[model samples]
Target: MIPSVPTLHSERFRLRPLVRDDARALFPTLGDPQQCLYLTRPAFGSEEELWGWLAEPGWNGRTWIAEDGEGEVVARVVAVPTDDPEVEEIGYITCAHRQGEGIARECTAALLAYLLGEEGKREVIAEVDAENIASIRLLDRLGFHRSALHIAFEETHKGVCDVAIYTLSRER
Candidate 1:
């Protein structure tokens, strides 16, 4: 069964479950090619396409949409269980216009607390493209250390790319 997603909050944001209307609210950012540069998927061509993708049913993870004080959707966060029951993988996409405002970092920090505390996850990991410096720095700021395992190359829509794995353990 899909686990229930609880609303999460940070000093400047409130994270809640994603809804259909979010497709419209997030399109300008999620559909931008520049914003999707280091993402696994390419930019969406239209709001309908993004909705279809967002509404697709195969994800076995918890997803949340982060909203700011004005009720604007500023980011999207997700936590997916890994092969090891004690570990969970986390990811986020910040709205293009809201980049550099600490939205992803703040919301993701809240997620880490939930996963490692309430959810009893021993570790939280994030697999990021090696070339994505911003994300690497964010992970560092969040106290995540680079894992020893290095993915030399992985083929994606962006072609062959190196992936860096970062992890934060509950004891850390």
Candidate 2:
């Protein structure tokens, strides 16, 4: 059986499935260094990779494209299931031109609400680069308290770097 798609909306943005048609709008944002500072990989070389990543199978995870009121995609948000069914990892990135507009925060909050409230997900985890203060602050505002710091969880494009893990539980 196919997993259900989630369409989440916030006051200023709409979070919908990351479709093939969004490649043109998404590539620029994913390719921008400033927008992907905390990401594990550098800019995606092709739209095919982006599409493939979104279409991959997972029971408790999904990717969403954030669009503004005028229907322009400004960012991407994702909730990926881990080995444990009760835990889901969340991450997001906004286009360079759209930073500081609260788009990431809005999209992330919507995703958290959908996962915890409707999907019954127990916990949401996020691994952010230690230097990415903006994302750290955003996660905190969304009720994700820091659970670990300066941990080497994965080998990223920037070599071995410290990351901070934050978690928001359903009980909170």
On lDDT, the candidate that comes out on top is 1
Candidate 2 backbone clash number: 0
Residue ranges of candidate 2 with Cα displaced over 4 Å = 52-60
Clashes of each: 0, 0
TM-score of 2: 0.88
Tens digits of per-residue lDDT for model 2 on 59-141?
45667889999999998888887888888898888877888888898888888899899989899999889888888899999
lDDT per residue for candidate 1 within 113-166, as digits (tens), equals: 999999999999999999999999999999999995456667777877889999
Worst window of 10 by summed lDDT in candidate 1: 148-157
The CA lDDT of each predicted structure is 0.91, 0.82
Model 2: residue 135 alpha-carbon error in angstroms: 0.7
| Model 1 pairs in collision | none
Question: Considering every candidate listed, which one attains the maximal TM-score?
Answer: 1
